[model samples]
Target: MNVHLGKTPVGLDGIAAAETVLSHVDGQQGELIIAGARVADLAAASGFEGVTARLWSAATTRSISEAEVRASLGLARQRAFARLPELLAATSGLTIVDGFRAGIAALRPEAGLDDEAAIVGACPVIAGALVQRARGSEPVAPDPDTSHAADTLRMVRGDTPDRGEVAALDTYLVTVSDHGMNASTFAARVVASTQADLFAAITAGYCALTGPLHGGAPEPVLEMLNAIGTRDNIRPWVDAALARGERLMGFGHRIYRVRDPRADVLKSAIERLAGGGADLPFASEVEAYIRTALRQKNPDRVLDTNVEFFTAILLDALRIPRQAFTPIFAVARAAGWTAHAREQQRTGRLIRPSSAYIGPRP
Candidate 1:
């Protein structure tokens, strides 16, 4: 017996494509819950590795441990470093995002390191390599003794990061761990539904992420702010952009009618970082002015602040170049993609949605 609901709204809006215990995004109330905890509390409390374990536990039958996840990831990082020279040689001269994707695509199943650990652990290393390449510096090797987020910062900067810097990046990673069945997550599920390997599903998600509508917003956030230059230029530039019908990048989200909950989580992370300089304060003012201007321009439409706005600021505060924003995002989001793939595979059902035929009368 086959069942047909027969309602395929454009973009699958208001659709529950899959059953997931991993994370839920309540756009109306602006709430994000991950693995039975609210996103804010989870990010504040758990390290990214712990969050990865939690998400994995929710999807898999086994009770995965934080220590196990951490240990596996540490070894995976070492292996990734071992493979780096070869990967870079094969992928020379590609842009940061492209090179990062190429490197991940080159991953083959290994004897001891599972694809799960390989995908998650390789993200920071790959993204950091791109940053180093852009700066004309040699890629820094991974340090297994340090925590994942700390090592990520260390690699990006080629220097050991202190506790606070590590904490900020961890919070950023934990906050973006999952958000319902997003485009990338859905794409991952589709790939996994066919019983594909973890690497394939994650690579599918990564491909979806590279799309301009999704992963492209955050880096451009810094670019827009740089173009605005100073606090004084915020209002005028916003007004002109709105007049010229240009979007204020990072301000809007397709899913969230209210402000993105991740933005608040990240904005708070920014407050905890060391540099309380003019940038955050100025960005705060810009955020306020843009919110008001956007509201005034279209009173009915709610295009509230999204994660990308604060993400750009937070990454900038950590001194990461704009070019590596999406790659870093892929690193964090790989946690979610892994779990979603597992969850989809458990159902043993393929994602086969039908399109309504609207052309050519018989």
Candidate 2:
């Protein structure tokens, strides 16, 4: 039995692909390419909204205007908001998984029947689950007049989002649009293997993503920066972290040895938001300082920064509230997850990979 699946067989080093544009992850080089260019270069060249259109086209083989996607998402968000009380009420006194279960149970069965509309419809349900959980309040109505990115900002912040802020959020959405078969994507596909609804599969995915090692890392990345306080103490903070055997949360990735492509794209967005006066300098500085220190400490650890750093930074700039970060991730990633789930379902094979038992067994 293989321990790690080693290095992807069949020459497919990354996730399984049904269609491809440019999202490539070279773990050896720590590089990520998006739409025929490096992630960094893509970030520099396009706004997040543009990237969303690009990814959606690649996935669907149909051209969808940003406005169209936004309109659809806005409508979906509105519907999710209307049903929020039920979702939130069911979530009370329940664990995250229980809450997810309750919400999935509450959602109608058609939501997972494999149509574009239903697939898009699940976006807000997944997002609203997280939003309500984070806010400690029931979810609000999603606005149809707003863009998907803008509505997300509005739902979380309880206010209209400025254009620049909306642009930043859209970039975040686009940057994370899809990443091949990540953990959560696989979780979704596994649940779908049972012919479960989109809500069920995505809820399963969200549960997988809720771990600190995954979607939960970004929110804490900000918290870590805040704890570190200032740039002056970055080395001590990181050194102390290493000393204590605490693995740095946002500083590295399982893939991408040089740097995570998404990080560069998001970093560019962060700088733009900062230029528009978002005041995320302290967080940015600490991240930069930490990266430099880590590289110096063990040049061989080859620990370059990854998406979580800028994920925290970008969400912070968008005024998305720390608690909402993971959910926001769920919203954008649901697109990729559903797309992959559909592709997996088409293959008609249960994702029942055999695990090697290492311990005493029957």
Candidate 3:
């Protein structure tokens, strides 16, 4: 029964595993479209709540209101807060994302809150709690009245974030909200295709995002910058790292043949936070130096900046620690995961792909 398709795709690259109207990534042109609009345009036009609502409505093929989603998430956060102590205890020895995994796994949907609302709403609560716990600080209560981005920073920093800082965070959350069929989104859809509950699918997505090749690269990007230590060390650092055959953490993308568009979106967001938050001048100087060095090294190839590069700087300026980078990514990407999950359940089949075996013939 040899039923394998054409040459099996390595890592499923170039595979159209699912069709989605939710988002599209045009790697050649470096464009991202979410909910029928360019990501840059959408991210610019809306906050996290608005972007999330748009994605949800597109995926479910219904008109879900942003205010309704926001209110539901607020209610869910209050409920999610009840489990923080237990989550903190259970996840004491784990990384922030691991704590999030435990917390998400523990979620049980209740009356008046659908699973999508429950997971998305509770994500910031869980992420913020883990961040606070990691810092040996008590988690602040969520302000359902405040926007999700502001409340998230509040819980982690134990202080109310100013308007600019809140806006920066909201921009970031919206920028990375959904990214076509990345590994994590695919994982979410795979689980959902199996008819698993939304929580189960989202948990799968969260687990996938913890991998270094995915959401885990931002902190390492910061580590690289810290290693360089100064603007003067930029070229020498690039040469040394390249000579040693180390991949620059945030320079290239597997999908994008050009500069990642999300890079620009986040870079602008960081710049806007320049009055107080992320050091835009230093980061720009470093980026320019590194980009030049990479282009000089690989003239025939296009190795340009990606999202993680500025993500590190932006989050660092916000006073978020290194460990929480991936967790916060999960917090932001939950919107995409839930939307993809619901879409799969509504429109796709159980994601069972066949494998091509090339072992010694029996």
Per-model TM-score versus the true fold = 0.95, 0.81, 0.96
Worst 10 residues of 2 by lDDT: 109-118
Top candidate by lDDT: 3
List model 3 lDDT by residue over 147-244, tens digit each: 98998898878898899899989999999999999999999999999999998899899999999999889998888888988888888888899889
Candidate 1 lDDT tens digits, 207-326: 899998988888788888889999889888999999999999888788898999999899998998856342788888889999999999999999999998998888888877778888
- Give every collision pair in model 2: 30-256, 30-257, 30-258, 48-171, 112-198
Error of 2 at 49 (Å): 6.7
**By TM-score, how accurate is candidate 2?**
0.81
Better of 1 and 3 by TM-score: 3
Q: lDDT scores for all predictions? A: 0.86, 0.66, 0.87
Candidate 3, after superposition: displacement of residue 57 in Å? 0.5
Alpha carbon lDDT at 352, candidate 1? 91
Q: Could you tell me the lDDT of residue 161 within candidate 2? A: 74
